[model samples]
Target: MYVFSAQRRAISIICIYMTYPYTTWQNCVYSIDRR
Candidate 1:
């Protein structure tokens, strides 16, 4: 059970790291469009 939980946590962390850059880039595009 501990290993499963740890694996789940790692997957979530990886997902967040993967998406962070995409969200940041999207926000930058939105800001540029506002200009």
Candidate 2:
């Protein structure tokens, strides 16, 4: 049970972090595309 909970916590953190970096990357791509 402990292991399962720990894994869920790690995945949720990574998912949020993934979104942060991905948005930055998308903005960079969009700016270059507009030019």
Candidate 3:
């Protein structure tokens, strides 16, 4: 059970890292469009 929980946590972290850049870029584009 511990191992499975750890694996899930790792996957969640990786997903967040992968999406973080795209989210930041989207926010930047939105700000530029507002200007």
Which candidate should be chosen as best, given TM-score against the real structure? 3
- The pairs that clash in candidate 3 are none
Q: Estimate every model's Cα lDDT from 0 to 1.
A: 0.54, 0.54, 0.54
Candidate 2 residue lDDT tens string, 1-35: 23436655565555567667566544543454466
How many clashing pairs in candidate 1?
0
Name the runs in model 1 displaced over 4 angstroms. 1-4, 21-35
Name model 3 segments beyond 4 Å from true.
1-4, 22-35
Q: What would the per-residue lDDT of candidate 1 be over residues 1-35, giving only the tens digit for each residue?
A: 13436655565566567667676544543454466
Better of 1 and 3 by TM-score: 3
Error of 3 at 4 (Å): 7.3
Per-residue error for 13 in candidate 3, Å, reads 0.3
Residue 26 accuracy (lDDT) in model 1: 44
Candidate 2 vs candidate 3: the TM-score winner is 3
Which runs in model 2 stand beyond 4 Å of their true positions? 1-4, 21-35
